[model samples]
Target: MKKIYIEIKWAFIYSITLLAWMLLENTLGWHQERIADQWWLTLLFIPFAVFIYLLAVREKRRRVYDRKMTWPQAFLSGAILSVFIALLTPISSYIINNYITPELFFNAMDYSTKNVGMTQSDANEYVLLTTYLWQSPIGALAFGLATAAIVALFVRKK
Candidate 1:
């Protein structure tokens, strides 16, 4: 439990750093400008990505006896992170749906209805699918694993 807390703390740190980076870069300059609702959504990914990396390490350490954890540890850490992120995915989506961009639903529906090659019915179906994708916890976990694996392969110490 203590270790999970520590890892979550690190994850928050990682998430905040990501937010700071984006703020610095102006990529997520929406909140400051008051024209954005998905800033929270963007920010949510930061800790999620970090959590995946850290948890993957936890996974690795759990299986290994060596004092130093290895690549497999990193890989599994990502998987663990992914599951956690998935579990918490609702918090962000709920915010987005209820507050951040309530209009997003209609707006996206409108755009897709007009812009895509698909029929309105098909477009609506796709939109719903995309919404569900955003809602899915498993997707988050899988992405976490992928991102963690990439980062681990390059970032882990030799």
Candidate 2:
């Protein structure tokens, strides 16, 4: 359990790091100016997810499995870490959307209107739907589990 706690701690720290990076980008207006319509920014989620799973599994292997962890153990550790991440997502999303980048929604709506050829009502609906999906804990759970399942395969030692 100590190993799991440590992994969860790291996961929390990583989440904060990601939130800070996002806030910095938004504060600089990068999302609005440069990447508004680009999907590249979505790539950022991969590394964070990979690191969370990899580090968790590695730590578990090192401390608990004598550096020879089985797939089940690796998967379990990664899944547990993902659960922590999912639990933390709502709070982080709230802080980021409400406090850090309240203008993000407007920017997104504008982008949708200009780039996606969306009507005002359609853009508004798009933002609201996507935001709700992104912030939804159910989505987080599904994504976390899938990420854990995939990343565990690579991180497992034995």
Candidate 3:
């Protein structure tokens, strides 16, 4: 536990960052008026996510390995961080869906049914909170591991 404290800390930071991003999107009308554009607009968060992974792995390398961490060591640290992020994703998503942008699912369903030609039932099933609660953690783990793999390469030191 103590050995991976940095990963835990960074996981919290990433979760907070995710909340902040969702709030920003909601403030910019992405969750309502600009709901159609939200799908593509959310891609903008990729860089920020990668940056956080880079920072986490780099910090682990410096603090735990004394600046001499190997690629595998950095990757392992990042993988641990990714697990932490996955564990926290459901809670973060609940906050976003319920508190930060309560209208998001409704807005998405409306847009999908009207513009995307999705059936009402399909929209309801796909856009609901339960789906997101499960999907968010899976997405976090997949993306987190991928980001960790890449970030590890760059952060690894001799």
Please provide, for model 2 over 3-100, each residue's C-alpha lDDT reduced to its tens digit, 9 standing for 90 to 100.
67766886787678768877767766666686563357656666866776677677778887898977787778777777787778788778877888
Q: Tell me the tens digit of each residue's lDDT in model 3 across 33-133.
A: 89989999999999999999999888887887888988889889888999999999988988987899988888999999999999999999989888889
Model 3 lowest lDDT segment of ten: 56-65
lDDT of 1 at 22: 41
Name the weakest run of 10 consecutive residues (lDDT summed) in model 1. Answer: 27-36
Q: Higher-TM-score candidate among 1 and 2?
A: 2
Would you list the rank order by TM-score, best first?
Answer: 3, 2, 1
The residue-by-residue lDDT of candidate 1 on 1-158, one tens digit each, is 75455345544444445445545434444433433344365655665556546554654455442445556756655555556666666664565456544555555556556654567777677667356656556666677767778756744444
The estimated TM-scores of all candidates read: 0.61, 0.82, 0.97
Those runs of model 2 whose alpha carbons end farther than 4 Å from true positions after fitting are 1-3, 35-38, 129-136
Best by lDDT: 3
Task: For model 2, state the Cα shift of residue 100 in Å.
Answer: 2.0
* Candidate 1 TM-score versus the reference: 0.61
Q: How many collisions per candidate?
A: 7, 0, 0
Model 1 global lDDT (CA atoms, 0 to 1)? 0.55
